[model samples]
Target: MEYRKKNSITGVLRGATFSGLLLCMAALLAGCSKDPAAGPEGGVVTVSFAAPAIGQETAVQIASAASQAQNGQSPATRAALAENTTVRVVAFTAATGNPVQANYVAEQTYYMSGGKLVPCTVDDNGSFVAVAPDAKMELERGSYDFYAITPALPLGSDKATVSVAHKVDYAASATKGVTVDASKTYTLTQLDRKCVRVTFVIKKSANFTELTALSVTPSGAGLSMPNLPAAQSVKMGADIPAAAGSETLTVPASAFTNTDATTATAATVLLPRSAADILLTCDLTYTTATGSSRQTSFSSTAKNLALEKGKHYTFTLTIYPFDVSFTVKAEFETTISDWTDVPAPAYPYVSEGRYIVSRDALGSSDQPLHPDWTAATMPAHNEVSAYNALSSEFEVAAEDCNSADASGVTPNPGNYQYTWANALPACAAYTQAGTSAGQWRLPTIKELETIYAKKDGLTGVGSFTSYYYWSATELSGASYGAWAVDFAHGNTDGNGKSSHNYVRCVRDI
Candidate 1:
């Protein structure tokens, strides 16, 4: 009996020791199990397992159901384990980074029926309301993603992640046919796409300063620009999606020709009358299945396109000049009539054209104005409406001038009342005075000052000659010689009255 008792004690001790060893092994396993990483930068993912409780006597029926069947297996327990053991993923993203045409955008980012990530086109600013709580989707037992492509996304919260929860029971066997049946019953509904509207018509003349001038700022459909002067050759570009698909470029009023024509050989500015020489350019854009954008620039070559003002075009004018500046007149002196004549002023024996009508007719400063003026039929500005107006008054005599009214010395003349109101309206009126025999008058001192451009040397624009072209009227003092423009080095010589000089005609609007 003593020997038997000692054997029993030894057996009990062995059992206890085995139990301690098992506990140690379990602790080590729990501490050392490998786990997966989860975050925006996704990598391998993992979860831990919970072992079954020991020495717990559950009720007969409940225990049988909860506990493993033969060889650690049960239907209910097996299902629960299977549900916890594996997970499926859902994916999301923005199809397009374009905002609705409003100050702000309110969007609802959600999964659609049949597992689609569909987005509604937004046109106004505000939150999306009246959306259902649940949505239908079709997804296999794997991974998925969701997101918005609209403008608000950048200002919105970071990407949201939903990890799948799963379990598996070692004590309960699982069947091969086990499934989660995630049947099109997921929801990302009412995901607000809040936004503000920014609706505006294209500025009549786009101020380079006002435009955002960014790469993705869309100007028109199928077009994008940096709101700046475009360069000739572009480097490899980065892509940005927009709301529009196409774009049009418009020049104010009318720049290029509207009919078929050809460009001149070496002319920088081509105003084609019957030939094609004008050009317009535009940018290109690409759309994604989810509505993204990528810009590719292109140039346009056409004979004529009727371009109206205020219309918006995708391509901006980056490198171009539109028109020629106004021509300026110069001054000179002569020795014909003494400037002291007051009672009755008389014209010289002959007259010349300010600029030898044909540039080839010109010569040195001391040379004769024109070889033919001495013998040709040269008329006085007094015969032309423009000069007559300056000589006579605010209004000239229709017989020799353009109008019957007379100024003699007020309003447009030496009068104290010279207003931009009168001049500006008259200038604008000239636009409609085509072929009215003659239109536009010689500018008085103040008016002419605008075009009296002078520089260090007569390098370009004006004729590089030192000669006089007579003004219609006499100087402020009758004894003073009538004013004349000198073209050589921009100046005015008003000392020679009877001196023979050039004449140019003008009219009133």
Candidate 2:
């Protein structure tokens, strides 16, 4: 009996029943004389994939499960593709043991169908079907080599090369030189999980306040595809690193959850297997009991951290209190376990400036004048007045101590110092949090002195210099002299208006 080629075999043989019929037809034509160069148009090829197996590190798996149960917790949720997945398959002539360009035969994609994978194609409306009427796979009854990849990437004209996206759940398997008898179903090797799960745990200490930033720099492997397909290199993540450079994942402080008073769960992420040791750096920014900000950082290398496939690595960082002089030491511990689902911690802060406050007992003087301070810029050294002319001086109020610098220029103007004329307008023009012009002004002499007293409490807002700061108070009986405060020793002194001193603006709440 002669088998005739049809418009499409995938469209007609969409179900198991139809596929079985095709298999029987191919088996019956097994003895028919057909050229190897031309495919067996009548023969059918059926393919199926096996689910990935759990890793074999029994001790770690058992302990992990036991610990979760003992702690009344569930396994962490993860991003895995086991139940429903798509795979791309390519076929080539079983010429040599290895796949070659000249040996390429045909390629087709498969999707899930009733618990089994079936050859599929996109229809005109973009819905997937068994196959498009215009395109389908037809193979002769012969031995062929097959290569497969899951969570398939788009196939190009050249079968071997394809672009992979950043951080994909990737897997690949190959079956070599297998006889394709239409009556027999071919099961390629199992598609195992090819990536590792990385989780972070922060061990809190009595002196621990907050972890501002953390970054992990990978030397190799975790940020790229495992060398596969022979001679082809594929890179992933935002930027591929050079020989000495590295890629990293920087998690902000807010992304951690304080599960308990002593321990907290941080970010959990997936990375491809690494061929080299992984190195990471953690930076902590915290406040001292005296309301002063302090920063400390430490780095460690996970020696021989190949990051085997389907494994989980837990890194615990413990911070130590500083010495009386504010010196600190930190330690790190790493644990390996079977890969399991893990939930990422939630980020803190509902809105800007909305954060938890400490209930520690303290005097009113221990608090900062402005807990949320916004630092302003001073005028340029060679800058001219932004508002007033060179021959102008702002009129001082009669109350010398109360005589503050007004916002606008005065009618009775005297030799205006470029720095002094620019100072008041710079503060008035400064805007933040809906602050309008005239809201901020040069601090009065007394106000400047008070800031110096409580300056140490201004933690994490920014820093200050020990130099002199301009004050709005005019010097008594001096035409061009204004009162200024030297933060170096909290001394009040008179400085000529022409001199340029640091200008810090303050506003009433």
Model 2, CA-based lDDT = 0.46
Local accuracy by lDDT, each model: 0.26, 0.46
Off-target runs (Cα >4 Å) in candidate 1 are 1-452, 455-462, 471-482, 486-499, 503-509
- Residues 392-499, model 1: lDDT tens digits: 112211111111122231233332222222322232222222233224343333212212342222122223224444444346555535666664555665645656
What TM-score does model 1 achieve against the real structure?
Answer: 0.22
Candidate 2 has its poorest 10 consecutive residues by lDDT at: 387-396
Candidate 2 lDDT at 451 equals 55
The candidate scoring highest on TM-score is: 2
